[model samples]
Target: MTSCGCLMLEKVEGDASAKTRVKAAPGAGAGAWCGSCAGDWRGRSEAIFPIYVMGSSRESTVAAARGIVDSPEDPIWVAVKAEAKSEAEKEPILSSFLYASVLSHDCLERALSFVLANRLEDPTLLATQLIDIFNDVMLNNKDICRSIRLDAQAFKDRDPACAQYSWALLYLKGYQSLQSYRIANILWNQGRKVLALALQSRISEVFAVDIHPGILSI
Candidate 1:
């Protein structure tokens, strides 16, 4: 699910238990898409929502975007690093992973770029090759970067399992998967559909979650 200049509805990766995906009932116009079972739709798209927003509605997504969508210099980045540093102190073996995942990146964008690039790397696009592209999207594209923060904030807001931002950043495959999709979506919008599909395939392969490019809603 990539960004489009036009308003588009996305069909998120479906859950087996869900009989059908839902959108907001009519009359909400195009601004709202409320998922009753376990998601929502907004400018953020369900690619990011199901993992972060959970069952939240458009209002929640908007509020999250308003509140936590800070720039690459957010203070929370500092706190996340501190938490990672403390955790590393407790578990030396995982210290390298923690550092590379969160502590090393100065901001959420860099961290997300690193995470998504590595996760989506394949024979065609090595992690090193994808890292530069992912970093460019995460840093230069405001919407995708903001979606990462909103999704992270939503995970904290909606999922009791998400006890910490660092946990979401480092541990959750759902969060990572959605962010990876967001980058792919960006690539798709840039007319790099082959690269986008390649990343999307890697996401499904690595995360066990598949979102069809054709999942459309009215």
Candidate 2:
């Protein structure tokens, strides 16, 4: 269903279930998860709890719900990634999706969703785009994004409270061409091919995240 910020309780697309769309109980505060069911609300907007449960069949729905409520402690990042995959399918409906899952998912999932959703064509703009959304997520959805930036910042040895959350460390690894992408654009007027290649190898070893070679070559 189309949303305009306020909580929406529309039926799922093609849903065959007889259950009615549920709403938060009266007087429930923000980030409160109240429903007819006995389960506790895990997300910020009470609205998201339902959408997260829109998978096929009751079993799948329960499994999806568990992903959000469970700790990121087991299997580490896998649960976070599972939640992300669920959110990704609901894109462009993201404002509502994010609002719904806000409290359910952790800070890391929130920041990463911003990154995954906004991936684009221009290689040179990658870092800038990541930082821009990171800031927006931090400023606009501080409750969710704050801890993520702090965690990412801690990895870089920077103060968690720092406003900018310089993405240098996060972006620096993975693809070989990313290093080249940065250098190529930074000194666009001056060429530095050799140093770019060296940076590429360093990224591969450290991040284990691969860059599309074609993206770099271009």
Candidate 3:
């Protein structure tokens, strides 16, 4: 089963009891499984399920999707790095800062971890310690990692002033504060209440955005 430049729902060769596997159709450029649909279809016995595919055939779709998911560098990170490099070349004063903040890191999570740690750090809570915590949380939790990029994309899309994704990531205090709160919330859930509160304090002090770490509403 396939559609023109769309998703291909194919039945896997296996026992009848086996769950169906889903992938992009060939020529489907960088396909992604729809979250709601995936959740709904998970563990079901049905062989033919509805999926949304943007590109073409089964082989190419699967390959493209795999490349996007398995690849260490994503489009968002690549764009941010390119923008940073361009800005660095144009403005000599910001070159060093851009290098340290965006260019030096391999991915959005690492760069964001560094930026947030530095922004929230103080005499008591060192930047190194915060980086470890942030990196641990962000890298370990794939959802958090995805959300960071989505938030960066949102800033670029929604804010007229935000000309580049790197600007939103590096300079937006609101964005920083939001990400800090996410980490703090995770800490609170993991029973690190004291550390979460400490992060909350730093968030308040630095970004002037007061949010309780205990708040589950992200």
Candidate 4:
């Protein structure tokens, strides 16, 4: 793994426990960097503690810092994933989607990136391309993902019809619509007008919810 700082994205592809590894730096705290010669790299304690820059660092660091603490996993996502695991064990039929969508990912943003990419992807527009874009957006501006979590949480907190995170994770069209709009809005502001409009149209068609691209978000 290329060394950026204290934390490294250590992956043993097939190993469940090795998805991502973070080495705490020497101060022996959450964000402390390793003081050893090989691991030593000058940086702030708060910066390296959590999942690590995982940026000069980019807008991603700024965005991600808002949502994450000392770990990569979000508590809300953890609870939802546990529910998915239980549901998968109880119902064999839903296992494939459950595992592919939620269980396979290490973080909430990653899973969202995968699902949205697949949903929006087409023959000419590859899933990899969509995934890359989604990852970029999420990493650069994690407030987007945080907004999504809040949106999903709102359903569970407020809507009587919605009781489970899995349902919002998998089947909520309105939630999907809002997320698609947010992604498209990012692209639109970044001067990718055509792609943004295309996504907006596709989102409307898929979710049956119309959202104006030109409309300003509060």
Candidate 5:
């Protein structure tokens, strides 16, 4: 097993409990790191958190923060906006200043919504979708004019100057493979026998994470 920080990614050619041997990073606490690190939906109580507090709607920020802390398992959650009844409360809202923050990126919206609505068993596919969305938004969202450049600059400043600096790291280290098999395990646990079998083959080809014969026997 290879370790990063306190987290470990096991090389389970096909172990039933392979994923359960690892721990999820604090940032990834909400999402299942693997089999063993499955945590409750409620947020972690760790003192250090990853909340982006740039220029954004305070209400939205608070709501988003609360959502992350409160519902770790949720991929998406709807927040209620407060309507102003008086002019004093109706201050003109400016554009979002959280342009470069990973959490604030609009590409994450769909996956979040999907996760919140359903206790999604697999975030691998959703994570891939999020990456594609980010690429599309960064390369083609033309309405923002100069803001796009500003946001792009911000991301460059905040992140390492590498192609796989973001969540794509999941694929680089074969985390995506574990996620797929975990999803398949979930389906198998849920008694969706046919679907589980179908996923097994797909996951093998896509992730290249082998399922060992001994692990399968479990």
Candidate 6:
């Protein structure tokens, strides 16, 4: 793996008779292969050139090679991730849940989408479908994104029971329901009344809080 934890496959040039060697790129750590990419490459001469593994694409590999880092993350999201990690360490039973809901995602929006989707998903409505809907609305609407962060902050600031931002994000039903309503409202405004109503029904079923999607709540 590279210094950035991205898997880098380097081809070793040698005699025609010699087998092509697969090794890590320059500046890679010792035994650089991550678990996903750890395998025998012997006799696989056809596997020439570098194969980027995990989240690293060819473009990302080139950027990493040039020592380029991704843009800075939102501070609220950074804190949420840190708190989730610490909570996971303290509560081993919740490790998988924390990882899946927070650590596995790159940003707050994605993580929140996953959480809400899973929570509201039913036999008829799959989590994957809900994720797409949630991602669409959350990613496109700047106002909703800002509201989500502010809501999370409010939970942490006002709710004495809410010790961490991740707590509000991951566990609070009220917070989750509020976010669901926000997405549903956007869908309703966009003339997707049927889909929005479905989401509203699901939210009511899951969170036990019924709110009209058409109503513009402040």
Q: Give per-residue lDDT, candidate 3, residue 139.
A: 89
1 or 5, greater by TM-score = 1
lDDT of 6 by residue, 1-218 (tens): 34555345455557674344445566666655556444533123224523312223347445532331232556678889999999899999999999999999998999999999999999999999999989999988878877787677667755777889998998899899999999999999999999999998888988999999999563
After TM-score superposition, what is the CA distance of residue 104 in candidate 2 from its true location, in Å? 24
Shift of residue 63 alpha carbon in model 3, Å: 18
lDDT of each: 0.69, 0.38, 0.77, 0.70, 0.35, 0.78
The predicted structure with the larger TM-score, 3 or 5, is: 3
Model 4 per-residue lDDT tens digits across residues 20-90:
35554444434534445233332332243433222224475455444544345676688779999999999
Q: What is candidate 3's CA lDDT for residue 109? A: 89
lDDT of 1 by residue, 1-218 (tens): 22222323545555564232444443444553235422323434455455543444568566656656554456456667888899999999999998898887777888877877777777777888888988887789877766777677767767879887888877899888877777777777778888778777878989998774333111
Off by over 4 Å in 2: 1-54, 57-60, 72-76, 79-118, 121-126, 138-218
lDDT of 2 by residue, 1-218 (tens): 11222233444445565343645445554433325322322332234443333222456545643543454553224433454455557665664644333324445444444443243214443545544533443345433332343333333333333222223222433221243243222222234444334434433444564443234432
lDDT of 3 at 159: 71
For candidate 2, which ten residues in a row score worst on lDDT? 168-177
Candidate 1: 10-residue stretch with minimal lDDT: 1-10
Worst 10 residues of 5 by lDDT: 78-87
Off by over 4 Å in 3: 1-73
For each of the candidates, give the backbone clash count. 0, 2, 9, 7, 14, 1
Q: For every model shown, what is its TM-score relative to the native structure? A: 0.67, 0.21, 0.67, 0.64, 0.27, 0.66
- Residue 204 shift from truth in candidate 2, angstroms: 30
CA shift of 206, model 4, Å: 0.8
lDDT of 4: 0.70
lDDT value, residue 110 of candidate 1: 84
- Pick by TM-score: 1 or 4, better one: 1
